[model samples]
Target: MSEAATRRGTTSIAPPDLLASLDPLLREWLPRQRWFAGKGRPVTGFALISATELLEPPLASPGVIHLLVQAEQHHQPIHVAGTPGHSSAPHADDCYQLLIGVRKALPPHLAPALIGHVTHGPLAGQTVYEGLHDPGIAELLLERLRLPGRLGELRFGRDTRVDIPFGLVPRALGAEQSNTSLVYGDTFILKLFRRVVPGVNPDLELPRALARQGCGRVPAPVAWFESHQPGAAAEPLVLGVLQPYLKGSADGWELALRMLAEGADFSGEARALGRATAEVHLALSRALPTATLGHTQVEQIAKGMTERLEAAAQAVPALRPYAPGLRSAFDALAQLGAEGRIWTAQRVHGDLHLGQCLRAPSGDWSIIDFEGEPARPLGERRMPQPTVRDVAGMLRSFDYAARSHQPWAPEWADTCRAAYCRGYAEASGSDPRTEPVILRAYETDKAVYEVLYEARHRPDWLPVPLAAVRRLAAPDPARDPGSGR
Candidate 1:
């Protein structure tokens, strides 16, 4: 550990003026980043919470810096409470884990990741870019994980039971939203959590548990690293995780859209995906502690759903018209709780969707990204929740994919939803449809979340969730009987 990587009193050592020099570059670059949670608001300033020089310059041409920078901004109210894009703590600055590479000059291929030239501070006249995009820096990260050890406050560890091969080429993946991923020789992929909070992230926790349970439905973690601040918090902040990459595996969203374009039936794939989801859920339940949500817990869940709807309605005028009807979903859920109903809860993939699943060439499905809603608190995400929450998210995803087609294919989405439910029922011994009230409430909550998200981020896509909002708020008994129709 270098002097700057050490802690003095309670503060992590930050090189003098390093953050000051990078301030302008980050302010301009952060908001435009896909993983940036504080979008729509300008970054006022940044405070360096921690900085670790993984490879110091003068010794290395392109040195790597691991930084936990807290960005100060005028954060908006949580868009839809507890949703993915919204920040967990609304009143505080957002902390980001950034792996930056400092180079005197950049090559052509690495130009896109450049933050800009630093004209002041320790890195004056050096070019800084996303470190993970640099193959050499990415390899250094893998080396750290390969040998379980500590670099300053950062610790790296791997599954000793598994051997990670060396000399794998690294390449950054472009499709991720809340994190950055780099593929290593088609054998391993490392996910660097962009927006971080202190605690063991579920992305690493759930998958490791599943691996021990011998559940292959989700890829097992290979190696990982985290920031361990002794005085800051009880738990360390999980920075990045390396897991086995499913080579030639097709993304479920892309596959769904392709099938839709070809006018092919996707119910089979949807059904298989459902079975895979249930398997993971079952493994999680068995691997982790399970609980029953009594009247109080149930009431809290309903209250949260209702509160989210109200918040979303306030932010989105369109949601106001349907707010009254939407409240009924949560109200009904609360009524059941008041009447002494109880539901089983357990650790679940809080943000499950088609996009999170991958179909291997052998037709098997594997789920990924157990980080839950990226912006939620790690502890809240790690808590037990009704498994139906995951089911509702996947159902919403099918609808999203269907809407992406030229002409909206409600039937296609409907068919996939039904097939998925049937498949889950077959595997889990409990159909999500059987819990009509819970399912409807969770699904409604998810739709309300989407409405606010799309309205805020992609205004053009707002109609997708608005359509669901219309259908969900209204009751057509002939078509569906679940919504008190």
Candidate 2:
């Protein structure tokens, strides 16, 4: 039997014919989606992993189908030695979760969600669209969370200690990347992970661990959903996580930008945020295992930083000139490691930045999104690293915010960064500034990563990190207060 026929024989929920016909529409629609990561690449084909009919025709106004699809993209081959005769794979596949809605006549309000009109199949002549945009279908998904149960291989789970009320109106968050989020009546927010991976996502894992440790700095996970494939030997992939929504909270990035615009002092807020971050780190360290990097490990860490700097220079030509200066920073770290210096590593907010924080109306800072760099492998992200890495990321964010605002105020970022470090020292009893070499190296490494990131993703934002690169590469006595020049 053909691939389509084999998939059709496996599932009885969504019609085989309807499932088979969605490939063409998905190929076009998926690339246009902001959450789709495989942009700029050709979608060669799609394979149906599983399709469950969430709401069937006649039973529901608009039919809803929960689809797990593996999309294959054309892979460009690289020349390698002794591989001239080796057969090359044509494409690479990535799994994506899509909730598709089918209706005969799409409502005017839902015109934005329309994928296209199905041409020929069981769903032919039907208006197919993204289901999350349809209010009724969105509500249905929330209902699944409210009543925890199993539907085929998909499982819904909720925290028994918490009570989640029913009938809350759902609205999708507009400015989400890498995932889709739904806010229900300002009480709860459900984040659906877009790219499916066969492991417990850190976003869910870390928050749950922090909640168990009684850490109030992070929103507690109230419920979640996951799916297990029939033959996969790996862990079940986490589909989504539901947590309490902080009402009347402003994101740290927005707060910083607003403060910068108004010429307001953000030192106090930055200090408080730093304290909150320290508390989270302390809590995580108490809850999870931590490792201390000795000579070998520290050397390995320095080598990794150096490798990243080299790679970034190769990718972004602008970084090439600053490579020597940046390599010096890494070299300093290597020297310190060679001298047998040891550093502590622990579970941290791997991807920390101003945007990853929120200032609640109560003036408390809450951390979210523990998922590390999205581009890195999952195993690498899961590994514990020096807490200073996170500190460097946030410090860079302060610089980014200042640069992003017109008429940049370098003094403002400096003040905020210093105050933040002071607050962290007060809370953690160890100041990051005291360890200047490691801290500076981490900050330099982070800026190098950002240079490459901004170059690839947002060319307009490239200057934000490049400015840091210039400042970091060329040490000015005025900027480096800790340096006894």
Candidate 3:
């Protein structure tokens, strides 16, 4: 056992047993956390994969321990295959990185960070809490990345020729969903990926590739940390990424909401953002491999969309009424595919929405969060998809903002969506609007996804996507090439 592990008394008790004792606490705590993805489901158990003491006594006033734990949720398989009288696995699992702080007595200032007091363990009576809430621990984490080093199984390193300044006060960024981010002064922000999976996270992979391709629309990665578990077959799991922070930039989502509130036109801003999206897409196509989706592949894509719609309808009762209309969109896509319509597929921002964008003071848009959809598997997210998928997501986002702003501005959303597609056509030399069938299909799929997302995460926002479902499901006379309606 390493020195830090020994000090934490990992030698005294097996890791599984140690984590088992804390499972009750974690089960209660994990679901309450904003970053927890398994919300609305019960966390049945936890399997501790690795634990490293980032900071221990003597090195610091209080101690900090970093842990990678797999939380298993109770799940029932739809059907069991190849079994006469047996059920499949009852649990689905997701891995999470936890930074736990240990102290003999909780300071009043650290009260909010408290996870709970360790009832029985080597560190019994010690108050345990989230370490990221503590600025000292956050600063220490940045310092660890500042100098290339390995602590236990965790490796912290920077990109070649990258220099990170030390001793800057760290503050946590708020309103993040799937990750915890700490900003060091005004220089850099380190995003700690909460739900972790093995292999390269696209958040790091895409930014690095874009930087190499000389794409300035993304924040440049400075350093990153990953963990390699012993005997693990897969590649190292990315734990966090550090990138230069763009100061004074406003989130695109907030900007759109603001514009809607003031009745200000956003077509120009939307158009420029569309161009920026094209630039990034072009860079990604140059940096990575691209694929042409033939009839067979397009059929598969359409099938996937139908599957998703069925799943969403089952989950959200509001979608049931609109299922027939939605099916028409996917069916049209399949018919188009059957006609040998070929579409280009390449790596895209994946989950491009207003919130994933930022507008700088220079009026240029920069995209962030290349992790794709948080709900999908990493492999699926990494797959190349039609660029119109991204374009459709942005269009859906425009509708989302307009509807969310009250008094529902459908005209505003339509105007911005058209301007965005026009700008994209100008930059990429491919008109997304011209492919009305594909664009409509992608937009409907995105809206279906939003229905489930809002139903689960934000119930009040359910009407936003529900309304979209009705509109997209209905055939548009204006969309008919022969009809002027």
Winner by lDDT = 1
Error of 2 at 127 (Å): 1.8
- Give lDDT tens digits, candidate 1, residues 316-401: 78778999888888888999999999998999999998888999999999999898987567778989999999999998899899
Q: Can you give the TM-score per candidate against the true fold?
A: 0.92, 0.92, 0.91
- Model 3, span 234-269: residue lDDT tens: 689999999989998999999999999999999999
Model 1 regions lying over 4 Å from their true place: 1-14, 75-91, 476-485
Model 3 lDDT at residue 65: 76
For model 3, what is the error of residue 344's alpha carbon versus the real structure, in angstroms, after optimal superposition? 1.1
Cα lDDT tens digits, model 2, 1-485, are: 12221122124445467666887888889989987867656788888777777666434558777888888887654222222321223235878999898899888999999899888877777888999987787778877776577776788889988987777889999998888999999999999988787786888888989998999999999999898778757578789999999999999999999999999999999899889989999999988899999888988888999998887776677778889988888888889889988888988888999999999988999999987877677778888889998899889888888888889888888898988898898899988888888888999998998886676668788888888888788854234522211
Per-model C-alpha lDDT, please?
Answer: 0.84, 0.82, 0.82
Clashes of each: 0, 0, 1
- Model 1 residue 397 CA deviation in Å: 1.4
TM-score of 3: 0.91
Residue 294 shift from truth in candidate 1, angstroms: 1.5
Error of 3 at 424 (Å): 1.1
Worst 10 residues of 2 by lDDT: 1-10
